[model samples]
Target: MTVRTRLLDPAVARAMSAVSAAAKKGLGDPALAELVVIRASQLNHCAFCLDMHLGIARGHGVDERRLDLLAAWEEAEEVFDERERAALALTEAVTVLTDGFVPDDVYDRAAAHFDATRLAHLIGLIVAINNWNRVMVGRRIPPGGYTP
Candidate 1:
């Protein structure tokens, strides 16, 4: 793969992964955490992340239909629950950044569903995935060959 940087420093990469792990652990719901990361990866067009996380999501027992309909989750109300929708909406708001900041409505909606700690972890997860997305996309990393 073509790289913009020689490579991320090994320590930095490990630190980022650690942050992601912490966020996922705090968030508590393995499947929901996967969904949030997958949504962010989708928006960021991080094929490497998508390939890796999709497999992880399936392992967590997330339904194929949910994965298939994630891009259209807002419209697929029947597939995604309110909590999942809230998380997905927050993921989009944070990932796209076209609106400058995550809108209050989206944040509030997510807050309504998740407690303070979980909300923080959810945000942390989004940030971590977004960072990972940028690194992989910036480096033009190809999907597959990802290790768990």
Candidate 2:
């Protein structure tokens, strides 16, 4: 499918960029943030986002094996730490909202690993990526075009 729009209006793009900046500043770990983005993209099945985030994650030094195993993070705990697992769980919850609500257990687990501010940032990142995924998927934005 062809792209519906080459870019969002400048104002809207700026707002989205601000949200991304906030996420980058708020989330201390670049690798963790990329993981959250990658997982959300995978769940949303957005090829553009998946391509972009996978490249970003690799730039942040996320291991190839970990990225490969992220789709099955539950069964590949050996590759993920507690914090990564918690973030992935949160990503899944946020991405698949129709499957069920974000469970209290998942939120609590992520909270246990992150402070209130960081948790808010993590949530923001999840929400932001989902928003991007919807836009890209809806517009059928082609993949492999993003540089970062």
Candidate 3:
């Protein structure tokens, strides 16, 4: 089915395209990026991103248990480790940017987990997903159409 709204507007699409190289740099595992994408999309209720990321995550060997419990990763002791946790925290902070600018504590925690360059890329990932979420949610992209 055709999406009700375009998934990528010109500006957002350009921004995403610009970040492609940086996102591919040696910041973190591609698998971890997929994990963060899935978790953030799940939290933001963005069907387009959730669909894309879940498939990527699975291709990278993410198990069903972890995927199923992603929304509750904090409460569940899944396979996600400290670095993943830090990425998740950053995702949550950026995705919900209105809750306030990403707090220093959040940035510091993520910085601790990742090097300067990796942390920058990590933040970029968060920003990218959050932008995607806003577009999808704002346009009210319908769900149940995304197949894993």
Candidate 4:
């Protein structure tokens, strides 16, 4: 597919950058953060993001096996820890909103694993990735073009 735009309008791009920077600062665990991003990108079917984030995730030392099983995280408890599972559950709940709004139980599970500050950061990361997914998908940004 042809690209629709090289970048979003300047104001929107700046806003997105700000959000991204804030999310990165808010979350401390690079590996966990990448998992959240990768999971959300997977759910959104954003190939550009998947390609980019997979590399970033690896750079953060996330395991190859975990990355391979991210799409099936629910069934791979042996590979994912409780914190990772909770984040994955939150990612699904937020990404698949049409399936239903995020359930309280899912939120509670994440809350149990993370304190309020980190929980907010996790939510921020989720929202930002979803936004990026929609923008890249809308632009038909090709996968494999991103370097990391």
Candidate 5:
């Protein structure tokens, strides 16, 4: 729990709350949102976000197996299906923000699973989590103190 700049102070918290409220309305499943957040946090090496999202995901009924295999999701035979995989891929692409935006093939794969509304929501979630990751990591937030 090394001291780091908190993203949500009394003033900034309001703005963050607005973003969270919108993400909640957009994201259909709390579990999926948590999963994407955790994965993106992991990619960004943001320990604060990883701990928070892991706790949130488990609270929403995500089990140990799926959590364990998340880093190596493609090689594992876990509970995630094609839709989840596609969303996960989207999460990666969005967080990385490299390779020239989200590729058409990735969008097509995700589109096959989610409707237009859900897709939009999913993208919003990805962007929000990635933004959090960038801020926390950039601020040099330390790990191992979080409960989850």
Candidate 6:
């Protein structure tokens, strides 16, 4: 498929990248944070993000089974811990927003697992990934386009 020309300003893209970096860093748990973004990309069907984050996650020593079972996280209770399940649930709730809102149960579960500051960073990370997913998918950017 032909990739569409990028319509977003270079500065805006740079800002978005910075937001993502900051959020990930602020979250302070590399393994959990990587999985959060990866799950968000999976839900949003962003191939470019999947390519970038999957490699990053693996590099950080995230389990192959966890990555493979991410899409079916709820059904793979044996693989993901309670904390991870909560994050993944929050990721999906934020990514889809099917009812135009995040369910209280999902938010509460995440809050129980993460303190207020980390919760905020987690939300920031989820929001950033969702936006990035939409932008990349809109531009038809392929998986291998991610350089780092």
TM-score of each: 0.96, 0.94, 0.81, 0.94, 0.87, 0.95
Q: Which stretches of candidate 3 lie over 4 Å from their true place?
A: 1-4, 7-14, 24-26, 143-148
- Per-residue lDDT of model 5, residues 1-148, tens digit only: 4556755566665675577658857877888888788889889998888888788889999998899889887777457888889999888887886886888888899999989988988888888877777777877887556663
Rank the candidate models, highest lDDT first.
1, 6, 4, 2, 5, 3
Order the numbered candidates by TM-score, best leading: 1, 6, 2, 4, 5, 3
**lDDT string, candidate 2, 43-144, tens digits:** 888998889889988998999999999899999979999999999999899889765699999999999999999999999999888888888888788898
Tell how far residue 3 is off in model 5, in angstroms.
Answer: 4.0
Per residue, candidate 4 scores C-alpha lDDT tens digits across 28-139 of 8899988999999998899999999999999999989999999999999899999989999998899998656999999999999999998998999899999999999999
lDDT agreement of model 1 with the native: 0.94
Q: Kindly report which residue pairs in candidate 2 clash with one another.
A: none
lDDT of 6 by residue, 33-127 (tens): 89999998988888989999999999899989889998899999999999999999999999989999999999999999999999999999999
Q: What C-alpha lDDT do the candidate models reach, one value each?
A: 0.94, 0.89, 0.77, 0.90, 0.81, 0.92
**Tens digit of per-residue lDDT, candidate 1, span 1-148:** 5656547799989999999999999999999999999999999999989999999999999999999999999999999999999999999999998879999999999999999999999999999999999999988888888777
Global lDDT of model 5: 0.81
Worst 10 residues of 3 by lDDT: 19-28
Q: Could you tell me how far off, in angstroms, the CA of residue 142 lies in candidate 2 after the best superposition?
A: 1.0
Error of 5 at 34 (Å): 0.8
Candidate 6, lDDT over the whole model:
0.92
Which candidate number has the best lDDT?
1
Overlapping backbone residue pairs in candidate 5 total 0
Better of 2 and 4 by TM-score: 2
Give the poorly placed runs of model 6, Cα more than 4 Å off.
none
The Cα error of candidate 5 at residue 91, in Å, is 0.5
In model 5, the runs with Cα more than 4 Å from the true position are 1-4, 7-9, 144-148
TM value for model 4: 0.94
